[model samples]
Target: MDTKKNIENISLLKEKMSDWRKLSDEELFLAVKEFEKMPRLEVSIYYQDLFNDPKFSKTLLDIYNKHKDNTKLVVLLVSAIGNMIQRYDLPESKEIYEFMLENSDKSKIGPYVAIFLPRLKNFESYDKKWEYFMNIKKMSPKKVAESSFETIMDLYLEKIPEHYKTEAIQYFNKKVEESNNEYGKQYYQDIINKIKS
Candidate 1:
């Protein structure tokens, strides 16, 4: 899919969202599902609207509560919220971030946590982020490489303690060395260099 086109569509949808009351529940649900399938930036716009609309907000929260036990629904909800937290400067962003951290299942929380790390200022207080990184070390190196890239970028941007920086670099370097993909290796190397410089 063309991510740029998806972004444009999201912009259009945002404009139309002021008139969302015109859309039936089925239409609104389908629109949200379609937006979720779009590029990450596009998904964020829909999520932002959901949070902004009183009706949609109630609907979404109902859906979340109803399907909180369904892993697929949980993944979709958490991922959508994560995309919003990453893409926009919304007023409820921090509350949403804290909610995800507190409510999401530990096994399925890594990706959402990785997405939030770069935007946050301090890493030391978010011990779960570090714990997630350490736990993922047991996975295959490819999984390790792909999974940790965002987390490493977050660490690079955040005010991580000096002691953690060394461990973070070593962890990223190990992933880079194990990564078979040249692009992935280069991305980690660039992050390492950026952090070191």
Candidate 2:
């Protein structure tokens, strides 16, 4: 594949994202998928450029403001922003997190929010992180359980605060016991042992 051309094409696609109303649904969907798969760092740079472009960001925000029914577009935006925050280690992640917190229920964007929370260095103290996890647990039990395991493992390895570390381990153990999958249980047990040491 011609990576340079792909990058340019991706940039071109993003340039038109604000004019999504002008494109057919199929075209918009394909374009969003293409942009989504671009190298994460590249996508972050793309968004940084877009954010810097007053015309583009204003137009994009206007479209989002007007098209409240366009759930797909909302998802794409949330996913893109979340990826940008995670991949770029952007300083603006807190702003994106705040945006997601405010708009999450309106767009059913909780999963993307969940994914973003773990990336924030100081996210451990945020009540929104727990709420995000609870929202996921209510809406997608399996995914919440799985992510809980992953998050706890990460916290243990990262050596988070003692209280939070205890909470993570307890949450993981609870979910592992409740989970039906034998492999999930074994994986949780292994991680629990790893954490203890």
lDDT of 2 by residue, 1-197 (tens): 46567657767877777678898867776766666565354444444553344454344445555554666675666665566546644444344555566554443445545555556665667665544543454443347445743763565475544555566567668868887999989877777666666
lDDT of 1 by residue, 86-182 (tens): 5543334344555565553345544444555435544436756555554444333336334655555555455555656686688779869987999
Off by over 4 Å in 1: 1-35, 38-55, 85-90, 93-95, 117-155, 181-183
Q: What lDDT score is found at residue 116 in candidate 1?
A: 55
Error of 1 at 181 (Å): 5.1
Off by over 4 Å in 2: 24-30, 39-63, 89-95, 103-108, 121-128, 156-171, 174-186, 194-197
Model 2, 162: alpha-carbon shift in Å?
Answer: 8.1
Model 1 is weakest, by summed lDDT over 10 consecutive residues, at 50-59
Cα lDDT computed for each candidate against the true fold = 0.54, 0.58
Q: How badly does each model clash, as a count of residue pairs?
A: 0, 0
TM-score for each of the candidates = 0.57, 0.63
Residue 105 C-alpha lDDT in model 2: 45
**lDDT, residue 119, model 1:** 55
